[model samples]
Target chain A: MSSEAMVVGVVGGGQLARMLHQAAISLGVRVVVLDPDAGCSAALAGAERFDGTWTSAEDLVAFSRSGVDVVTFDHELTDPADLRVLERESPVPVRPGPATKLLAQDKLHARTTFAARGLPVPAFAEVATAEDVAAFAGEHGWPVVLKARRGGYDGRGVWILADRDAAATVLADAEGIPGFLVEELVDLAAEVSVMVARRPSGERRAWPTFVTTQVDGICTEVILGGDAGPAGLAERARELALDLAEQAGLTGVMAVELFVTRDGELRINELACRPHNSGHVTMDSCVTDQFEQHLRAVLDLPLGAPDPLVDAAVMVNVLGGPDPWDREGLTDALAVEDATLHLYGKGHRPGRKLGHVNAVGATVEQARTRARAVADALGSP
Target chain B: MSSEAMVVGVVGGGQLARMLHQAAISLGVRVVVLDPDAGCSAALAGAERFDGTWTSAEDLVAFSRSGVDVVTFDHELTDPADLRVLERESPVPVRPGPATKLLAQDKLHARTTFAARGLPVPAFAEVATAEDVAAFAGEHGWPVVLKARRGGYDGRGVWILADRDAAATVLADAEGIPGFLVEELVDLAAEVSVMVARRPSGERRAWPTFVTTQVDGICTEVILGGDAGPAGLAERARELALDLAEQAGLTGVMAVELFVTRDGELRINELACRPHNSGHVTMDSCVTDQFEQHLRAVLDLPLGAPDPLVDAAVMVNVLGGPDPWDREGLTDALAVEDATLHLYGKGHRPGRKLGHVNAVGATVEQARTRARAVADALGSP
Candidate 1:
């Protein structure tokens, strides 16, 4: 019955893939996930599976060759070499192609690329030895940020050094690891993210900029469509994001995380080539959600309107609580009628993200209050 | 990992079940379908299958016993006796229980029951022979409607007779049918439908009445939140529907199809005990869609808000066309970005319901115009 239907193969069976599968079903499209775990999160969503590890070139190539019209990703964790092999051997194309992924998978590469394209980024340089760290800090500042070039996500592989002692402690701890980058830490202000989707046909659309809240370097909240900043800042943020998408040759949704200094200067912080936590607000607030737009872009279909449908929408993350399970908390969370809750169906692990609550209102404060209440009621049990 | 999760078993695995599975996935709930056709529409949505038939008591009982927390339905086509058997033999509860389903299954039972409860219905009588139809017509009018007591849907098993000869022809054609009903052909100024979701706890929520357009007997379009009628007519329709739901002891979503006569009277026409076609507009317009609401109602979860999120939402059905398949038409239809399209993964069959398009706007006319354009562009392939 689906002989002529479009099929997309996703690299990781995570929450992003689960949502992609959900969005695809309404359009009569099929999503197949490739993952090593047979019971990954996307499996609960009933996504078809191709059992394989993203780290292996053989697995990547086989999955790409298996009946899918296009290949995509839930995360940028696949090995660059493996993706290169898949690109050369498989008939299907891998979206957000290997080159763009390198710009996400390798922080140093992303920093260099953004800087080269006239995108504002912090002063940065590669450093490995004690002398290297000291020389960079001497030029920039004493307190600096240390980051690994690859294999980092969700606050992992990152260290903030305040002074000599802190810098020495981190350098000693990272004895043998090779790739490293150091950057000057700027004065704290606010954090924001802009998500944009690009199609292979050069069509691109951007969701409005969202102000985000971070706890321990993890996104805790995202507020969309509220002009809580200086005039023209959001518009400039969108322009920067769209320009980055074009420069990276992006073919799917990409989240451009940015930092606003105390003096109102915007600097690029990080890049995620797939759906990011910040885009969750679009699930309820925008005409086209990030997940659906990602699918449309990968399938080479017309991009959906990225404009907000409501005045404001807020999304609050739900982390696993201290208890083994809290069925009552789940019920209580759902009772917040104005909010929409999404549980990822993963088993509880304290401090781990398990779900999120979204609410839309006439103002950012109203939506944020409702979302916060739902998240609090869903407190770790 | 999901040993504590809730599972719902659906009696039919059609488009309704497909959408239920899609909705449940976001809430960490699982939906299992019992259908003889392993490749039913719900299967495309990744719903688990029970490998049974709705018409078989053994199949239903075994499915209900298969570790499900609740047993629900996609359509009212399940055999009432089979449902009763499952209720008596299985541990799970059957929502929209056997008693309520009997009213939807048998036209005579629904008419007599509605009339007995002081609800308005056209003058109707049981008819099994030519004399029965003729005698009822003589009292009511020359033109009447002949309907089977059971097994009728989408214009099937119904006949409009203008004279004695026409009534005689229908009586002859329905020779083996054991039961039938004859009703006065009331002058219909408009057709409307109101959908209500009732939990086993007696908590009921109703969607606003929708003005629907029908081609033959199939609903072709639905418009919500339009004040096109006399003052207070929509509110009255909702009250009547809520009252009927209570009278039927409904435990799930029920669509009350009604006829607004030229004489300014509201009369119930037909009863659907599961998600009905008219409620499709809620999928995009209301805060709580019928599919998700049906799952929540059956699961006995706190009901979500049912108010409209937009000023207006319109849905237009897409029928299959002359060609074997029209991928180009599908693309053209989707290019109408203002409308959201849902295409059931069914093979081409001329005049068959292929899918639907839903659009929300500032006005009913605007939404309807966009929806109609999508449906027209998706013209039969």
Candidate 2:
């Protein structure tokens, strides 16, 4: 309660950290980011940057002691073992602790944890060889999903195998490595995600569920509305997310990616234990955006309302193209009715996420059209 | 432009500049601020802060040449001669230039300029002696308003005189100095302000007129609604602001304060040639906030829509109180329905502006009550 503002240290300096720095400015909170990349998105906002990698315990512990009140993450890239060292040595507490972050870092660990905790998850089995995958496919049907146990994101260490031959090809591509994880491919009616903010006090709130669209395993758009997909499921999705959030012991904002099956059941897909791209729709519509909510949660301050201020909102991701991200259409993007554009200060590479456009209106279709217009004007990849 | 984000140099690091830094982070723009105080409000945002004063011509010119695409003022504190040097010597354009900024720095000059251009203004006069004050009072009324010709804000250097006796007391207090300006104290109605963003290309846009409430010469609350004041004068106010924006050649956001007469004419009162406090309401309610609009305008990219996204919104200034500002209530303030709190990182001193809370709703009264509640929770001065 002193006059000095609270300082929050972020582990990664990506778009989440960048948006957190922006939100912190108004709260009078000082944000310090420890990212090895000096030109990281957050460094552009002037968040005092420390040159350190998130995975290095020595750097994280050293960075944590340098006047931070608490430490949080923008991504789950830190080794849980390293973070345990941080929690032991640092003066301030590490949010989500090692256990929660372990779930985010290791997919096989999270699936087992969810299963043991009675949380809904797709049928799965940890595999160590192609024969194990073949057995799981025989039980759960073909077109199984193969996933790395750890350190893979944005569709990178994931594979879809139609049968034993395809599974053999994936194993061969991986130099015949036997270790990986496989799961039953749900009859997905739609893909949805929910954002939850939980403090150590066990105080938590959930943002409206978002129905997402994916292309080639990468999220392309996020939509928020009363009837975005399967009828009357938004409230149930939020409840499901909150229940799993408690099980995950998530701190700050966590995105619970879920698969809504055609059989009317919600099955957990993956856990993103941080402010996520799917929640980007909240930035332009929610009463308190997820970035601010994350700060409040980590600081253990009173939580903010997670409800949207608009009827519907949607966000379209802008990816880098063959040339480069053309910000020249910024004016035209702003000209789109009810559209707001946000571009990350990053160098363009083909198919890389450069930024996003959010639009709000009375209906999902109306919002989606305007948001698409802005992304198209910006030459969306 | 070649995949490069534009850079802007702001001459002052107050709350306006701080808010601009927040807006620019999302736009991928770089902001460089020149301020002598290492701990100015904007410095906390991590904008690259240059150690310099706004008044020094050497500093102004040097800061502008530091690879800025355009230079803009957060306040009109720069000496006009000094800015003229910056305009001539620096590669970047000085928006609102020396001539436009001079009018903001010198009120007497603005009144005279508005008078000459046939703009709506109260009857006024230039006075250098007690006799001149008496002559203006004789024509206008017994009681008149006196203001300093330049360098005054937030209730400083302004006096309301009752008669010759009161006038004599003010003169004696000033040691017989008579170099000031005087105006007729109009029969009261209401006070309102409009913000305009004009690009060098002559493209301009005006935000909705805000009816503001002042307490002892300090703006306490700003209300935005069609019926905020007597009858419907918002449209007329916007037109008048746009007209003066062209006359002033202002290439960024300009706030024009106006006084409504008991009978129904809006007379121009003051000009703030940068992002002004009256437009702070736009941050929470408008499609394009004034801070972002200022960047768009000064960069000459394109003017944004200045319309409010909500039906009505209101902002209450949180002034420093008896103790230091209690950001402890940040949680409760945010809990106020539809309220968003913004705190300027300031060392609190009684009567100094600290920050503001904005709330939006279906009606002005609804928004005001919520905004007031948030301000009260924050221990508003």
DockQ of each: 0.53, 0.52
Estimate the TM-score for candidate 2: 0.96
Off by over 4 Å in 2: A173-178, A325-327, B1-3, B173-178, B325-331
The digit string of per-residue lDDT tens for model 2 on B1-381 reads: 314768989999999999999998878888889999988888888888888998789999889878888999888777777888889998889997888888788888999888988888899898766777898998888789988787778887788988877777776677433268889998768899999999998998998899998888888899987464555577889899999898888899898999989888899989999999999999978767889889988988777667677887899998776776445566667668778888888887776788998888889899999999987777775
lDDT of 1 by residue, A103-160 (tens): 8999999998888877899999998766788889999987889998888788888888
**How well is each residue in A96-117 modelled by candidate 2, as lDDT tens digits?**
7888888888889889988997
Candidate 1 clash pair list:
A321-A380, A323-A381, B321-B380, B323-B381
lDDT of 1 by residue, B308-373 (tens): 777788999878766544666666666676678787777667798877888877888898888887
